[model samples]
Target: MTYATPPRRTLTALTMTTLLAGGLLLGQTAAAPDASAAGGKKVVCEVDKMRQQSHSLRARAARLQRLGATAEARKARAQADALDRRVRACVDADGNAPKPWN
Candidate 1:
């Protein structure tokens, strides 16, 4: 019995698939460092801004509490908490500590 060779179309398809996969991997590796650096910087800046906003919100909440606007104070506090959580998530995603605000 003789073994049958693969059709030309089948061989062409396999070769194209291999080349496409290799090109994708190479493109990703080449782009990774620049993308990460830009992304990291953006995350750090965002986290810092969120931290500042959170602090302002907390102060506003305290002032509202002093003036007997308990409902407003609570709302402000909740906003501050959400901002804090957002900052934490950004820091975690960035994989580094954010720079101190100047």
Candidate 2:
């Protein structure tokens, strides 16, 4: 049998980080979004998702212009951009507050 090393505290920390990253990815995979986590670090995660989606939507809208699908592309891009802006506003407002996050 091969000798295996026992887990240490550092391994626990690494596991926590991996789990957190996975949760963020899963949270962003939903179409409706889990805004329930908005009070914590998950807000940051949502901001990242919104930013990524906005960038992708913008790029797709630009490509659509070349394909002459401007109207639909622009509409969808507007929605994505609105979500991105809201996410940014949440980030800015959260950091500006002077109260607890209960």
Candidate 3:
């Protein structure tokens, strides 16, 4: 009587296939915030989130600058500026003009 074990490559392929299937299933079931479910305040929530993100990015940019990473700091500042513009537009659309950040 004899039994055979799968080759190393076969086992590796099987493991990878199983992991890929599991990842796909998880991605399909992931939940995200829904605008329609927010009762008309979705934009406000989004603007607030953007504000927080921009603030963090700006802080990171400052830290990067102090660390002498000019290119990375510039990138972070650019992203922060973009988010600030979007936040301003969102606030203006809501009829409440945004003030400059302190």
lDDT of each: 0.85, 0.79, 0.85
Q: What's model 1's lDDT at 61?
A: 99
Kindly list the per-residue Cα lDDT of model 1 for residues 1-50, writing each as its tens digit. 97556797789889999999999999999876664555566434477778
Q: TM-scores, in order shown?
A: 0.50, 0.48, 0.49
Residue-level lDDT tens digits of model 2 in 1-102: 964456676787889999999999887787555557645454443777788888888888888878999897888789787988888788887888787765
* Candidate 3, 1-102: lDDT as tens digits: 754556877888899999999999888778644547346554444877889999999999999999999999999999999999988787777776566782
What RMSD does model 1 have? 8.5
Residue 54 deviation, candidate 3, in Å? Answer: 0.5
- Lowest lDDT 10-mer window, candidate 2? 36-45
Runs with alpha carbons beyond 4 Å of true place in candidate 2: 1-45, 99-102
Q: What's the best-to-worst order under TM-score?
A: 1, 3, 2
